[model samples]
Target: MAPLSDPAPRLARAAEAPALAALVERAYAPWVAVIGRRPAPMQDDYTARISAGQTWVVAVDGALAGAAVIEERPDCLWLDNVAVDPAHHGGGLGRALLRFVGREALRRGLPQVGLITNEKMARNIALYQRLGFEEVERREEHGFRRVEFRIAAAHLAG
Candidate 1:
C-alpha cells in the first residue's frame, strides 16, 4: 500500500470516537504484552474525550490516522494520550502530532506541554527526548510505572 500524506490535525468530532478508539487500540496493541496487560489508552472513553474537546485527530484521505488527547492544565497542556495507527508508524505522523501539541500549548498561552508514558516503552521515551521533552520524573501511577516528560512551548514554536 502507498504511504499516506500527513494532514493537518483537528479537533475530533463526537462521531469519530469509534474510529479514534480503534486507532488507539491499533497503536497501543504492541505494548500490551510488554506491559503485561492492556495499556491505559486502550480502555479510555473516547466518546467522553471527544465531547470534552480534548481529542485531536489527523486524517489522511479522509480516514483517521493519528490522534492526541490533551487537557489544558493550569501550567501546561497535559497530553493524556498520543496514538498513531501502527501502519503509520515511522511516517512522521507522530512527530507532527507532537508539534501540534506544542502549537496547541502556545495557543492556550501555556508555558509547556506535559505527557506520561509507560517506562516499558523505551522507544517512545527516546523519541520524546529527541523532540526536546525533558524528563520530569518517574513514579507508579494507577498500577503502572510512568515516566513524565515536559517541553517548553517556546521550543516548539515555528
Candidate 2:
C-alpha cells in the first residue's frame, strides 16, 4: 500500500459501526495481555456512539484504519478512545486523530481536551505525554488502574 498522506478523520456513519468496531478490536488486541483484559474500547457499542454523533473515523487507502470516540463534557472534550489498526501503526494516524481532538475541542469552545488510558500501557502514556498531554491523576476506575491526561486547547493552537 502507498504511504498515508495525513489522513483526515470524519464523523463516523452508523453503517460503519461494525467496521469501526473491528478496527478498534484489532487496534487494542495487543493490550489485552498487558492489561489482563479487553480494554474498554474493545467492548464499546460503536453503533450507540455513532448515533450519539461522538465517533470519528480515519481511512487509509480507502479502508477504515483508525477511529476516535469523544464526548463533549461541560468543561472539556473528553477523548474517550483513539485506535489505529495495528497494520497502520507508526504511520502518524494516531497523531492525526489526536490533533483532530484539539481542533474539535476548540471548535466546540472547550478549553481543554482530556483522555484516560490504562496505567499498565506505559507506551501509550508516554505517547500521550509526548503529544503534549499532561498527566492529571492516577486512580483505579471500573476495575482498571487509569491515568488521566489533559492539554489546554490553546496549547495546540497552530
Candidate 3:
C-alpha cells in the first residue's frame, strides 16, 4: 500500500455540487448493482452531503477513485458514505479515506466516530472492525438490515 502522499492523488475541497454528485454516483454503482436499485436516492443524499461540507474525494493520479463523507452531530461524527471505485478497491485508497476521517474526527474534538453497514456486507463490517471500530448496535432501516459501529472515545486524538 502506498502512503496517501507517496505519489499523491490530488486531494481538494470539492464545493462544486454537480461534480461531487457525479463522483458519488460512479463510485457507488458497483455496490448499488448488488442491491439491484437505482442510485438516485443515494445520489441526492450525497449531493446534499457535499453541499453541506460533509464530504470529500481523492483522485488516484487525477481520476476519481474514491470518496468519503462525514456528518458531525453533537456527540459523534458519522461516516455517512465511503466508496471506492470497484476497479480500484485494493489499492489502499479506502483505508486512506478512513484514516483521513479519523484524523478529522480527532481534530474537531469528536470523542467518537460511528458508521453503519449493510448486514449483508460482511466484508465491509469486517473492514470497519479492522480499522478499530466495534459493533455497538444493529437494526433494520429502510428495508435494509444494518450494523452500527462506533470508535471508542478514548482512542480519539483530540
Candidate 4:
C-alpha cells in the first residue's frame, strides 16, 4: 500500500458490523486458542460499538483489510481493540491504524490512549511498544494475565 500514515476519509464507516466482526475474529482467534477464551465479543454476536471515540480502518483496493476501536470514556481515550485481517497481517495496516490513534489522541488533547493485551502475547506487546505505548499496569483476570499500556499525548505528538 502507499503511505498508510495518511488518513483515508470515512473509510471506517464502510466497515459495517459484520465485516468488522469477521476481521476481529480472524485477529483474535489465535489469541482465543492461546488464552482459552475469547477476548472481546465473539463471532455471530459481535457488535461494533465504537461510538465514544472513533473507529479507523485500513483498506486496499476497496476491501476491508483492517480496523481499530478507539473509545473515549470519561477517564481516558481507550484503544479498545485493533486487528488486521489475517490475510493482510504484516502489511503495514496495523501500524497505519495505530498512527491513526496517535493522531486522533493528539487532535483531541487527550492525556493518553490505553489498552490491554494478554501478557502471553509477547509480540503484541512489542508492537505496542514500537507504536509508542508504555506498559502502565498489569492484572490477572479469569486466568489470564493482562497488561495495560498507555501512550501519553505528548508521546503521540512527538
Candidate 5:
C-alpha cells in the first residue's frame, strides 16, 4: 500500500472539479460492470457540489488522492460520494473520510451520519459495518438496489 497522507482534508475548490470527478470515476470504474451501468455518484455535478461547500479533498504529497461529498441534512450528515483513487486503495483513506464525516456530523449538531451503496457491493457494506454503521434499510430506487447505513453519535462514542 502507498504511504498515507498527513494533510487534513480541505474544502474542495471549484477549479478542482475535473480532477475530483476523474478520481471518482477511477475509483468506481470496477463497479460499472457489476452494477450494469454507471453509479449515480459517477454522474453527480461536482462543480455544483464544490460550489455549495459540500465537497472535501485529501491530498498526499500534494497530489489529490481521495475525495468525499457530504450533504448536511435536517437530522444527519449524508455521505453522498466517497472515492479514493484506485492506486491509493487499502491505505485507509476511505475510512479516514468516513471518520471525517462522523466528525462533521458531530460538529454540525447532527445526530448521525448516513450513506448508501449498491446492495451488491458486499465488501463496501461490510467495511461500513465494521466502522460502526448499521444497516438500516434496503430498497430499490433510481434503477439500483441500495442498502442504507447510518452511524449514530452514540455508536461513534462507543
Candidate 6:
C-alpha cells in the first residue's frame, strides 16, 4: 500500500466491468449490514453503464482505486454512484471523484449535481455536506430510506 498519488479518472471500458464492480462492492461492503441489504451499486448493470460511457474509473499508479457512475439528466448531472476502495480510503479519492463530477456537470452545462445515499450512511452524508451538498429530502424507495443531496453548479464555482 504505497500512499495514493492523485487519482486519474478516465472513462471506463466495457472490458473493465468486472474490475469496476469489484471496486464498488469492496467500497460498499461495510454499508451492507447497516443498510440491511446489498446496496444498489453492488447490483448495478456495469456492462450497460460502461457501454453507455457513464462510468468513470479513477486509477492510482495504474491500479483501480475508485469509480463514479454519472448520468446526464436534462436539468442536472445525476451522480448515481461513487466508490473508493477501502484499501485506498483516507487518501481523498472520494472527494476527488466528487470534484470530478462537479466539473463534469459544469462542462456539460448542467445546473447541478444530485445523488442519493442510504440514510444510515451518516458518515457519507456528513462528507457530502462538508463538500457543499445540501440535503434536499429523504424518502423511501426500493425498500431503502434514501437521503438525496444536491450541489448547484454555482456553488462549485467557488
Q: Tell me model 5's lDDT, rounded to 2 decimals.
A: 0.85
Q: lDDT tens string, model 3, 1-158?
A: 35543223233354545555666676666657565664333546654565577767776555666777788889888888777766676777777677677777877888788988777667788888876889998998877778999985445221
Best by lDDT: 1
Better structure of 1 and 4 per TM-score: 1
Candidate 4 lDDT, tens digit per residue, 48-151?
A: 36343256677667766777777776656787777888888766667767767766777777778789988878889998888678898899966668999988
- Please give the RMSD to the true structure for each candidate, in Å: 2.3, 1.9, 3.5, 2.9, 2.4, 2.3
TM-score for each of the candidates: 0.94, 0.94, 0.78, 0.81, 0.92, 0.93
The residue-by-residue lDDT of candidate 6 on 1-158, one tens digit each, is 33343455899988889989999889999999998899999999999999999999877766688998999999899999999999888877777788778888999999899999999999999988987999999999998899999999657533
Candidate 6 runs further than 4 Å off:
1-5
Candidate 4 TM-score, C-alpha based? 0.81
> Judged by lDDT relative to the true structure, which candidate is superior, 3 or 5?
5
Worst 10 residues of 1 by lDDT: 1-10
Global local distance difference test of model 1: 0.89
Candidates ranked by lDDT, best first?
1, 2, 6, 5, 4, 3
Instruction: Please give the lDDT score for candidate 6.
Output: 0.87
Which of the two, 2 or 6, has more TM-score?
A: 2
Candidate 5 has what TM-score?
0.92
- Which prediction has more favorable lDDT, 1 or 3? 1
Stretches of candidate 3 exceeding 4 Å from the true structure: 1-16, 36-41, 153-158
Per-residue lDDT, model 5, residue 54, is 96
**lDDT against the true structure, each candidate:** 0.89, 0.88, 0.69, 0.71, 0.85, 0.87
Q: TM-score for candidate 2, please give it.
A: 0.94
Residue by residue across 28-132, what tens digits does model 1's lDDT show? 989999999999999999999999999999887777899999999999999999999987887877877877888889999999999999999998999889888
